[model samples]
Target: MGILEVSNVNKRFGGLQALGNVNLDVAKGTVHAIIGPNGAGKSTLLNVLVGKLVPDTGTVLFNGTSVLGLKPFEINQLGISRVFQTPEIFSDLSVFENMLIPCFAKRDGSFRMHALESIASEKDIIEKAEHMLAEVNMADKRHMTASSLSRGDKRRLEMAMCLVQEPKLLLLDEPTAGMARADTNNTIDLLNQIHDSREITMVIIEHDMHVVFSLAKRITVLAQGTPLVEDTPDNIKGHPKVKEAYLGEAAA
Candidate 1:
């Protein structure tokens, strides 16, 4: 069995069938990419994985434990972390200060923004945060305001924050969205580095074919809230269903 598994999952919104009977298996220590056209239920499935949304009739198991009904932070405690499309950070705070917030997170999922001022006396936490920042190549920008950084740097800092928590599974929603080519390439390199250096498993939901092809060990193509195909990157590239999903019947 894979480390994370979704079995017979279904979700609906009034008259809209947001997710059909969907299933996904993400093995340990591999990068799995889920790509599909707009409105293909990719976001819905991702939400289920992260505990933000519960499936109506399915099981989302992380290491054999059911994650349904758990809160987002509760899921985080289970070694799952999610990076949203837009970087989630304290815009006014310095990059280092933003990094310190996660370090002070309480077991009950509470954080004191003012606690940052007291972090100086916490030598170990400081060291750990600094190490993570350095790992993402953001150490030099530690004192810069998070809002002042470029989009790529913001992504780097956000990733550092997630890495500091040391999650076993990282879910990225369009990690390279809205990035220039240079930033996108840099993000790709950073993700490759992280994958090479850690035992973490990543599940990415992306629209960019380049990002998906560049990072995924396995790819699942979703269409109209169902998985059309799942295979290695090369096989997915030549998949007729995938072509029809993105392009019309002509491509297929």
Candidate 2:
């Protein structure tokens, strides 16, 4: 059994079927990529996994436990973390401060609004945050305002925030979207570092074939809200159906 399993899942919206009997198994500590053309329900599937959307049928299991009805925070507590396509850091806060937020949340179980209590006083939290920043190679920019950082740095900071929680599974939605070539390569390297250092399982949704082939041990192709194919990178590249549905005939 994989660390994360989606078994016969289905979702619908009014007259449209968003996901139809989709099944996926993500092995532990492996980078699994999900790719498809637009309107393929890739984002919808991610929403379901992160607890933003409830499926109409089937179950989502993480590490052999059911995660169907759990809230987002509850799911996080179960060791599943999600990073959105856009960086969701505090623009007004420094990179260090942003990392501290997740550390605090993981420790305290929720956000504390007491402005008088110095966040610096939380020594353990500070250390954890700094360690995560170092893991993502953002330690040098820890004191910089999140808004002042470049786009790639913002994404790195967000990743640091998630990593501080020590999640078992990391869900990434178009992690390299809108990045320049250098930034995309940097993101890939960071992900590689994370995979090597942690036992975290990953499910990545990406449009770039290069990034998918480089990072993923296995790839699943979704088409019209259903799984079209799931195979190794080499098999996916040669798949005629994948070429017909996603990669153009000329490219194949």
Candidate 3:
């Protein structure tokens, strides 16, 4: 079995069927992309994976354990981390301080966010946070206010924050959304470096075909809240159904 599996998952909102028996199997250490047109339930699926939304009649299994009723933080404790489309950071804090937030919460059973005073005494966590920032090439901006950084840099810092947790599965929702070509390329290269350096599995939900083709080892095409096709990048490129559902014939 894959490291993460979603079997026959269904979700609904009043009269709208947001997800219809969606199924996904993501192998360990691979980058999987899920793409579809607008209103295709991509965000909902990501939410379900991260325990923000629970499925009505199916199962989400991480390493064969049911994650249905788990809280968001509970799911994080199980080695799953999610990066939202927008950078989720403390706008007032410096890069270094933001990086320390997650690291300071590592405790047994329950986790606590260490206050600034408490964090000052933990040399090891501080060092580890610095190392992560350095790896992401943001160590130089350690003291820079997060809000002052460019959009791309803010996204980089956000990813670094998620990486420090050493999650088994990383879910990215439009990681490169709103980036210019240069920033998009930088994000792609950074992702390649992350994959090469670690054994983390990623499931990215993206609308940008360039970003999807750049990082996806496998692609699942969703349409009208249902999965239409799942295939490798090459096979998905000129696929008739995929072209119909997402990329038009001209795009193909």
Candidate 1 ranges beyond 4 A from true positions: 106-117
Q: Candidate 3 — which residues are off by over 4 angstroms?
A: 107-110, 113-117, 247-252
Q: Give residue 169's error in model 1 in angstroms.
A: 0.3
Return the TM-score for each candidate structure: 0.94, 0.93, 0.94
What does the lDDT read for residue 123 in candidate 1? 89
For model 1, residues 1-252, the per-residue Cα lDDT tens digits are 999999999999899899998989999999999999999999999999888888889899999999999999889878888898999989999999998877666222554456445657878778877888887778899999999998888888888888888889999999999999988998998899889988789999998899889999999999999999999999998788889999989988
Per-residue lDDT of 32 in model 3: 97
Task: Write down the RMSD of all candidates, one decimal each.
Answer: 2.1, 1.9, 2.1
Worst 10 residues of 1 by lDDT: 106-115
After TM-score superposition, the amount by which residue 168's alpha carbon in candidate 3 deviates from its true location, in angstroms, is 0.4
Going through the candidates in order, what is the number of backbone clashes in each?
A: 0, 0, 0
* lDDT of each residue in 1-252, candidate 2, tens digit only: 999999999999999999999999999989999999998999999999989899999999998999998888888888889998998889999898898888888887855577788876889988888888887788899889999999988888888888888889999999999999999998999899889888678999999998999899999999989998999999999798898787566765
Global lDDT for candidate 2? 0.90
